[model samples]
Structure formats: C-alpha cells, structure tokens
Target: MEVVFERVEGRRYRVGVRRSGRHDTGPDVPPRVGVGAPVGDVPHDLVHLAIEEALGLRLGIFGQVAAGGDLGGFFTPPPADRSPLRDKRRSQRLARAGRSDTGLSESLAACVGHDGRLRGADELLTPAELGRVQRRLTALVDAWRATPPGGELVVTWPEHLTVRRGVLPSD
Candidate 1:
C-alpha cells in the first residue's frame, strides 16, 4: 500500500493510504487528514512508519491498513463493497493477524520524540537495528521537511507485513 503524507501548511498535514490492488486516486480518495501538533520535526505517523519498518511490525497500524483494515475508520472503505458481513470477516482476519511489536514501535517512536536516541541492544532492537532506525528517521525527516506545502511525500507500507494470502491465521 502507498502512504501519502501531504503538507497542508505549517504544522497541518494529511495522511492517506492507497491500498494494494488500487491505482489512480481520483476525486473519490478518502481524506485521511491529521491536523496534529506533532512533537518531533516529522509527523507522528511518519515516525511510526519509519520505526515500524525498521523493526518490522507487521500487525501495526500501517500493516493493518495494507491488509485492508479501515483501522477504526482512519481510512474509508471502497464504495463498491458495502457488505457489512464482508467487513466483519475482514475484522476477524485482522484479529487473527495476532500480536506484533506494535507496543515496541510506539515506545521507540516516543523515545525518538523525547530523547532523540535509542540505547544499544535490547529485546526490541539491537544496536545495529537502532542505528538503522536513526538513519532512516534522519533520511525521512529530511525529505519530509524539504517537501513544499500542497506537495506529497509518498511512502510504501510493505504488504508482506501482513499474513500471506489464503493461509488463515488461527483466531
């Protein structure tokens, strides 16, 4: 799935996801806008993405989105598929996605916002992996700050972060 981060102006921003198998976001695109006063130089969700990708949190927010979960209406569903039963099954599938390092991702994201660093070697990430997160955050924040208002900074949430097709995870 494609993650779109748009600079509305100043600290205002909009974030939206284009799910897999989707192309050409026309006028009907759901406006997943967030007007947040983010603590760090980068948006909070962006931090989550960077940290999550570095640590590989498959059942995290973006991963759920990639697997087509609306994430409690953070994203809007397609107009064509209106079946509530289908939605229920999707939710069930997501629940079956089980635990991920989402809690860790959140903690690390908060750490970056406050202390701006991660200590060497822990259960969540090793020294090298922490270094990777720092490097990635640096690059992503640099690019994000450079983007002009009304412009988009596109990102990809790895689809394989979720379960493989047809291999139903036990509930």
Candidate 2:
C-alpha cells in the first residue's frame, strides 16, 4: 500500500492512497485507480474507497469536521483560495460539528443508521471499524519500535484530530 500526502494548508493534508490491485491489467495498459478529491473539497468517494479497500468491504462511513475550525486545515492543498462569499454560517456549522472524533464515528453511524450494524447505506461502523483503525495505528507504532522500519502511516492533527487511541497520559 502507498499513501500520498499533499499539503493543503495549516495542519490539513490531502491524502491520496494507492494500494495493491487485485484486478488484472490489459496487455497494453496498466490497471490504475484514480481516487481524487479537489483540494479543500470533501472526497467522500475516495474515503469510502479507502475504507472498503482497507477493510475488505464497502461502508456508509462518513468523515465530518467540527463547524468551528477551518475544514481545509484537515487535508493537504486546501481550497482557501476560493471565494469567501460562500455561506459562512453553514460552513461554520460544518466546521464546528463535522470534525473527526467520536463525531466522525457518530456521523458514520448516522450514515449507516443509528443502529450499529453495517447494513445497506444505513450501516456506519461495526466494533470492527474501531478495532481496525486502532490495530492499524498500534501496528505502526510497534513497527517503528522494531528494526528496519518500512511502511508509512501519516496521522494528522491540525488542531488535534482525536478518536480514542488507547489511553492518554492523564487516563
């Protein structure tokens, strides 16, 4: 798996991921997946694809940011250069309420449904979703603690992207 990061603005990073493919390529062309979201734009499709590929199943999971902070600050190549005449109020709402945290998990749950099952568009997160992300992070830390480090996993925190990673110093 290959992870690509493009600087957006502030602490935000636009992440592009390409991983091992199971599909076969034509004799003349290589099979490639183009997953992109316009800078500063929410790449929901790309995110869904990442989760599906990572977890081996599609999900109704959604990523949200708080309505109080700069949304572009979460990804790389942010779209701050756009017109400011847009709806500042609604934008603020999304910024403040849409941030990643339990809020993200909540939104994922909402997308799938309030029930914690992974049904059609109503399935947001399974206990497995939480476990998958946690395990992935732990493995990264463990690998770093080991020798001959190889894989790269970027964990971004523009203004602290929190989602329960074991216990903090105080806990």
Candidate 3:
C-alpha cells in the first residue's frame, strides 16, 4: 500500500492511501481510506508512521491498514460496500490490537504528533531506538516540508511489517 500525504495549504494536509488489488472495506469501513486536517509542526499520521516503522510496531495503525483492518475512526474510509461478514473478518484481523506495541505506537505518536520530534519518550523506547525514531521523523518532516502545495509525499508501508494472521509480535 502507498500512503500519500498531499499538502493542501500552509499547515493543512490530506492523506490518501492506495492499496494494491481491491481495497478492504466492510459494513463500517469504506473502500478508500484517507484523512485531511490541519497540521502542526508535521502531520500526525506521519509521526505515527515514523515511530511505528522505526520501532517495528507492525500491529500499530499503519500495519492494521496494510493488512486491511479498520483502525477504529483514526483514519477515514471514504467509499465502499458494507458487508457484515467482511466487517467481522476485519475485526478478527485487527484483534492483534491487544499487543502492547499497538497502543505504545499511538501513545508515542502523541508525544511528537505536532512537535515533529520526540520528547520524554525514553521509557517507551530505548535511547538507541529513540534516536532512530527522531532521526527518521526529521527526514520525513523534511520531505513533507520541501513538498510544495498541491504536491504529495508518497511512502510505501513496509511489506515485512504488514500484519498477517499467525504472524505477530512476540508479546
């Protein structure tokens, strides 16, 4: 899946995701998933991506999406057919939310969501991991900054980190 962040205006951005093959949708989820909102220092989801990817939190928000699971309402699903069975299947797939890293990524992203850098998150990440996430965020934010209005920064969800049944975090 490719995550595209488009700059709509100063401090405003929209995120559109395109997954290979048919998009996963259900009774409550749309065929397409995306969001548009005001941005602070950097895009909120971008922070989630940076922290989760750097820390290998595969069952976090992006991982859920990559595996075609609706992440509650954090990401907006635009259009699609609704099926009760599909929704139930999606729920089963997302059951991995019980993993600590899932919530850990959400909490960690909040720490740097708007500020675009890590702050006081040492407990969640070791010193080495924190440094890595910070560095990765800096690079991602830079790319987003350099993108002109109407332009987009597209990133691929790492294939190895994508959530899969029978494969999950040790925790």
Candidate 4:
C-alpha cells in the first residue's frame, strides 16, 4: 500500500491510499480508499484507527495495524515534498494548540458515518474494542513522541492492504 498525504488548504489534508502493483493505464483508475480532514477535527487518540480504515485495513476479523507492531511509523512524515504553504499552515495549527510547530507533524484521526458507511481515519468498534484500540494507539503515539526530534515518521504497508475473515463486528 502507498499512502499519499496531500496538503489541501490550511491545516486540512487529503489522504489517499492505493494498492500497490496496480497499473494506472487509464484515466479512470481510482484509489482503493481515501480520506480527508483538518488536523483539529478528530480526536488524536483515534488517529491510527482512522488511518487503518482509510487504508482498508479492518475489512477482516483483525486489522493489520493492530496485528503489526509498527503503528508508530504512521506518525512518520510522508515522502512528499513539503511546500512552504503546508508548513506554515501546520505550524499555525500546532501553535494554536499550544504545541511546538517546529519539527512536528500534527495529526488527527476520526471516523465519520457517511452514507451508512464509516469513513475517515477510524474503524467502527464496540466500546470494549474501541478501548483496546485506544490503549494500543496511545502507546504507539507515546513511542513516536519519544523518537528523537528531526526523525521522520514513515508509514509502511503490509503486502496485502486488506484480508478476509470469518467473523468481525457488524456494528
């Protein structure tokens, strides 16, 4: 999977996740999944969950991010050009939140109910399941924060973006 985080405007960003190995031979090709939102809209605790869903990670009984131990990597910066506009916008958002804008990437994730489908960077989960995911993600974020300043956050993908499972929560 290749996740592209594009700066839309201000602190808003558009995240597109595409399956690798697919040829974009035509103009009608579409990404496997996509999501977008401003940094402050979603609760920080749920960001990883949102990214997993946007990347089609929870279609199975177990999501890949939960299965894998590299959730901290998602906080890594994308391998994209950083424009002055994006930097300034991100800095402004961080400053408003009383956090240092320098050498930090502000990220937020949440799930939105759209057309009877959950969208954005979160998965639909039961209260118990949500709590479990929250704890896991919080630990990951803490590790990410502990990384040396100027270190990059890189999001790596599993060979398959989605897997099949016999059982998962319907709600």
Best by lDDT: 3
Worst 10 residues of 4 by lDDT: 24-33
Candidate scoring better on lDDT of 2 and 4: 4
Better of 1 and 4 by lDDT: 1
Candidate 4 residue lDDT tens string, 50-155: 3344334432211322221112232223235544454334333323332321112122232422111223323345555445545545544444444443332223
Report how far off residue 33 is in candidate 3 (Å): 9.9
If the candidates were sorted by their lDDT against the true structure, best first, what order would they fall in? 3, 1, 4, 2
The 0-to-1 C-alpha lDDT of every candidate, in the order given, reads: 0.65, 0.31, 0.68, 0.33
Q: Which portions of model 3 miss their true places by more than 4 Å? A: 21-39, 72-84, 95-99, 113-115, 165-171
- Tell me the spans in candidate 2 whose CA falls farther than 4 Å from its real position: 1-81, 85-90, 96-130, 143-171
lDDT of 4 at 165: 25
Q: How many clashing residue pairs appear in each of the predictions shown? A: 0, 27, 1, 5
Model 1, TM vs. native: 0.78
Query: If both were scored by TM-score, which would come out higher, candidate 2 or candidate 4?
Result: 4
Better of 3 and 4 by lDDT: 3
lDDT of 3 at 38: 27
- What are the clashing pairs of model 1? none
Q: Return the clash pairs for model 3, or none.
A: 31-79
Cα lDDT tens digits, model 1, 28-72, are 236566634454556777887888777677766666566655543
- Tell me each candidate's RMSD, in Å, in order: 3.8, 16.7, 4.7, 16.1
lDDT of 1: 0.65
